[model samples]
Target: MNTTTAATEANVTVATIRDWARRGIIAATKAAGRWVIDTASLAHRIAIGAMKRPAKPARKATFSVETMLAIGGSRWQKNGMDRVYINNWANFLPLEIDQYKTGNISWAAWEGQEIANRQALLLLGSIDKVWFDSADGELHGRFGSGESRIATRQEVWETVVAGIRTAIAAL
Candidate 1:
């Protein structure tokens, strides 16, 4: 199969097929100066991907303000994230929020007024998309660098709570 067909069949980009060909990850040969991937090999690759998916729903998820702040670290207390993750839970959210109405001051303004130099980790940069797996109680994502990375759940939770503390103090 040609690179275009192989990519579609494998549910990946054409560029990925080309890279696999160049790296000998799949069996391929030049035809009309283009890659002709082996269908059987592509099928094997697809099987491997299926085995790696998370058991949970795998829906798109964003970090909460506390989670993002925790990822930013000590600096978050002074300078909120340079750009809020998920457009930031705090950006337009009211300062004094309740079930009935939102306060006049926004959290984004609050952070800017309180701190500076706010750019840092809200999630692993290597991973382009992130999701939470409630069943396993873990975060799952594929790194852009073409490999899997692992971090302890404990560390994630600690930072999550720390961020909440920062927000409470800002209040």
Candidate 2:
């Protein structure tokens, strides 16, 4: 059988089948510049693979704020970035109610924010109506309508932790 057919039968990739043939781990021959795998040899290889012990699970890589940030100030953040740069990243992690009066999107106080569905959700706790109170400098929200309770800074940080930063680090 061809490498493709062998790979399907063996429950592996075609590349793996080719590699095995190249390494002489399976009885195969090249005809018309393609690998022809022997059925008996493929069966033998499958049996051997089944007999082998499963490999240990990979160690979970550290991907939290502490592990990925430039600062460890009880937050995931950095300072000294220019206004344009900060605003750009702040837009990356947008808020449902953005009322930055100064147009200065805070970026240094966003710790543990990626877990929230939206920045407002972080403070509002999964609500329908949400808004930012610029005068009080807080987020506001309620169950379905009418009057909003302020989402205080004490409830969550003012700044936003850009998810792109952590996402890149993961790669």
User: What TM-score should be assigned to candidate 2?
Assistant: 0.33
- Per-residue C-alpha lDDT of model 1 across residues 1-171, encoded as one tens digit per residue: 766577657755454676798899898986533466888898998888789974444334343444444433221222432322322322111111112144322111111122111111222222343333333434343343322122233343343333334343423
Per-prediction TM-score to the true structure, in the order listed = 0.34, 0.33
TM-score of 1: 0.34
The lDDT for every candidate, in the order shown, is 0.42, 0.44
Model 2, total clashes = 1
Q: Give stretches of model 1 more than 4 Å off.
A: 55-171
Worst 10 residues of 2 by lDDT: 81-90
User: Measured by C-alpha RMSD in angstroms, how accurate is candidate 1?
Assistant: 20.1
